[model samples]
Target chain A: MRGAGNRYVFWAVALAAALAAPLALTNNYQLGVAHQALIFALLATGYNLLLGFTGLVSFGHIALFAIGAYASAILVVTFGAPFLVGVGAAAIIAGLVGVVIAMPALRIKGHYLTLLTLALGEVIRLLIRSMESLTHGSQGFSGIPRPEIFGMSFRAGVPLYYLLLFALVLGVAFVWRIEATRYGRAFKAVRDSEIGAEVCGVRTDHVKVLAFGVSAVFAGVAGSLYAHTMRFISPEFFSLGLTITLLAMVLIGGRGTVIGPIVGAILLISLPEWLRFVKDYYLILFGLAIWLCAIALPDGLAGAAARLLQARNSVRGRASLRT
Target chain B: MVELLSVRDVGKTFGGLKALDGVSFGLAKGEVLGLVGPNGSGKSTMINVLSGVYRPDGGDVRLDGRSLVGAKPSAIAAAGLSRTFQNLQIFGGLSVRENVLVGRDCRLRSGMLGGVFGLGGSLREEREAKSLAADLLEKVGLARFVDAPPSMLSYGQRRLLEVARALAADPKVLMLDEPCAGQSQAEADALAVLIRALAKTGIAVIVIEHNMRFVMNLVDRIVALNFGRKIAEGTPEAIRGDEAVIEAYLGRRGHAERR
Candidate 1:
């Protein structure tokens, strides 16, 4: 935390492992799981901007994901548009909707805001389920083609894994970069104390809105990627359960830190597989993880790690002084 | 008298209680104005109104002839008015330097896209902001804690951090709501010196403090409030002897005894 070198090394090692992951996977099934994990990581990272950085608790974020998925699916399957156009439209549509969601959020605080967003999310989900012609009714959009961009195809699991990996890298890098900028500070300012931020000239409304829009854009891109990779999507998949999972990812991983959501996503996504012995008992584990996180890691895993890092650094400093 | 900031008939009500009645005052550039009163006398309400935290229920506030009555707190801050909270409002998650940088944010021109990409100009803006934050922290005697979180600082240090953060904005008019609340005598003296130095730089200052000794010696003039109404406004010496001012601080019994 003191210098950039250690942080760079951690990223370098992580990146190297991610780039090498596709080759190490035994089968396409594992790669598919990796794909979902990476996509969730990106979505949760963007959502972190609102939850962890800006102190917003939004239950309708999954609705934005639904919008992105549906927007891309409708465009690509029905309109005969290219894959890139579909993803682009998804990002734009979700980002716009995110801004809309932020408007109501501006005036409300705590539980009321959460309730409003929850209702809004349900309405969006219902709209998707009812839009029979566009969303194929409750049967869900299927037969969606794999990603093809610039004459290159990501049809195979490995290539798709690489593509997804690239997206997550870009997404994480963007959050990391923004954390050093003024906007990042503004977001945190709103989270810490809205009145204080306002007094200091930080436009809390704009910050919150920007946070929602940007996070929705992340959900959009993640949704589009999920659609193309899975080749199927249903309104139910982007419902309340997934929203809870996304929240768990950000909260359990580290709410505000760049790598928190990524770690949370990876761990939670794979936790079910690791718990195959218990079959459906993984939900219990998920609940347990969240409960433990709340009591033990109020700042999440990243904050815990940072504390350890600081302690170690202090110890090393004292040792050096003695030497 | 210089008319740098003009407050005209400003009023605020919370429920049935009038927190501030029709109160008016003028602040001149480079003048140190002290607002002293009994605990509930609307001194804080006045600062809150001017800083845009609360929109005045009636009348207007003009900064250099531009009405800021209904402007957002941020807009007023952008227009170069800044203040600290009486109850400390430190950003616990941010380092001390970053907290000050938040104050300088209004003056920054970097866009979200450019900032995310780490564009050259955005980087430069960040560097400049950091340097400014560092400079302000040094002035407020918290240079060593620039990278530490505000929570790590003492109560007095946190207060100083708030001032440093407010000053980082390069405000034309700065208001401090109880800046010396938890400060040691030495720290209070240091802050008084800082206030005088800030006034010398021609930035109009309004300080709300109950420390009469500190206020009397440091401020060029004083305004006393009782029950949200301006009871007296004059030079510090004049305010010191004003019966209304004495009654406001110590009740009618003290005023009668003085008489």
Candidate 2:
């Protein structure tokens, strides 16, 4: 399963879903859920690049995501830029914000950095909330343009769903390529040990900055898609809750692994929707489940599954030896 | 003979204690200088100051006649000086080969965008670096342990791996802080030979060690330190007979059982 065959199977399943999702679910409600899930997938993957691979966490990721969305939203709403340009602008703006935030926090470690980033995010939220003239205050800006291209308006949820799926594919591919390269090795070196990396002549400052920038770019892209899909923008959307959910997806899927984030996003985002029958107690049960999973399977779903599969394979090997 | 590295009255203080005070030394091209002292002698601190780990309170360090006092650690490394820590600072989660690869950070030409696209030039550079790292590993007798992580290697093997990693930087001057700290007699002999061979390549080497026998055999000249002050600087034979050197090593302890 660790070979090309496994990758083929994964891509086949993903492709089938991308093609059939719109056909099977014509209702706007279902399409909306699918679209939102894709956006979450992007956010969760971006978080995975930091939390899983580099062993750095930023509670301010939501703020960077919000900054991207706001930047893009402002461009489209006020300046009338093209949709693609808005997305690019969002990524660059978010990446620059990442550099500013990572500079101070990179010098510190553990909870100090965590708290600093969280406070930074809170500061961004406050600024957004108080800027009555620019950000429209707490009510937020409405009538955001839908994701459109070549004069074909993405007016329906089904079209938006396809757009998000395409984005998810591109994002996943980019991450996969990064994981296989030398830059990825440098990032891993920084995460494993800072002094060790520096002694080896690694400019850890550059590595951390690059990781932050790339992760921010992805988060920004996700945020842009979220704004467009909803056709609305708000300070309420990029909350602490969303940040926690994004982290949960990374942890649950297994941090550091490429496909793990996708698995995490799909399960966590879709699970609550499928459990609507127990809507009243849904959050309580979900939290309990996450707590239990974290304690029992700390490496996340991917690690647990790999362990189980290895055990089964070992047992089979023993059986074959006996024969 | 031009000095490739110079330290001028560098001083470091830890609160009420002065770890290093008014310590000055110079390393000429291809010189194998041994730094020897008893416990709390500041031999390691001198190396730390040169490597930019600790900024000196009172003086300066110059590499190739250029001042490097307040430069960052990476900047110091990039300026053609590399070092190995007394405690094995090899990346534990990385393989031995990968550990060496990290040491080649300054040598790598591939940048962010080049690596992101996996372009031909970057891939070629990566392959070339890997080959060079492999060659260095073989030279240090770590060829078989190429894929083994630091956590899996023995203490002596880890010590050798640190030297191999340092060599990966291709530095003009290499400082080894106690390269023979936790090694056996056989390992120490082998390392002493390796240090001599490295010095033969015309790269200045500074070795910090408490093992008098190893340093005596490996170094051409020895610089002895006591409480951050130089007591004697001469040939290994000359320093061995110096009264201050004996006093530094045998303080309160009888000189009978000393090696």
TM-score of chain A of each: 0.98, 0.94
Candidate 1 residues A121-207, lDDT tens each? Answer: 999999999989889979989999999998899999888888999999889888988898999999999999999999899988999
Every candidate's DockQ is: 0.90, 0.50
Off by over 4 Å in 2: A1-28, A305-323, B252-259
lDDT of 2 by residue, A151-212 (tens): 87776777778788889888888888776565676778888877767767788888888888
lDDT of 1 by residue, B83-201 (tens): 99999999999999999999999999999999988775988888888998999999999999988878789999999999999998899999999999999999999999999999999
| Model 1 chain A: ten consecutive residues of lowest lDDT | A1-10
Question: Model 1: how far is B99 from its true place, Å?
Answer: 0.4
Tell me how far candidate 1 lies from the true structure as C-alpha RMSD in angstroms.
1.4
lDDT of 2 by residue, B43-115 (tens): 9888888888888899878888899998878778888888998877877656888888888877888777777
Strongest candidate by DockQ: 1
User: Interface RMSD (C-alpha) of each candidate?
Assistant: 0.6, 1.7
Sorted into a CAPRI-style docking class, model 2 comes out as medium
True contacts kept of each: 0.87, 0.56
lDDT, model 1: 0.92
- Pairs of residues at least 3 apart in sequence or in different chains that clash in candidate 2: none
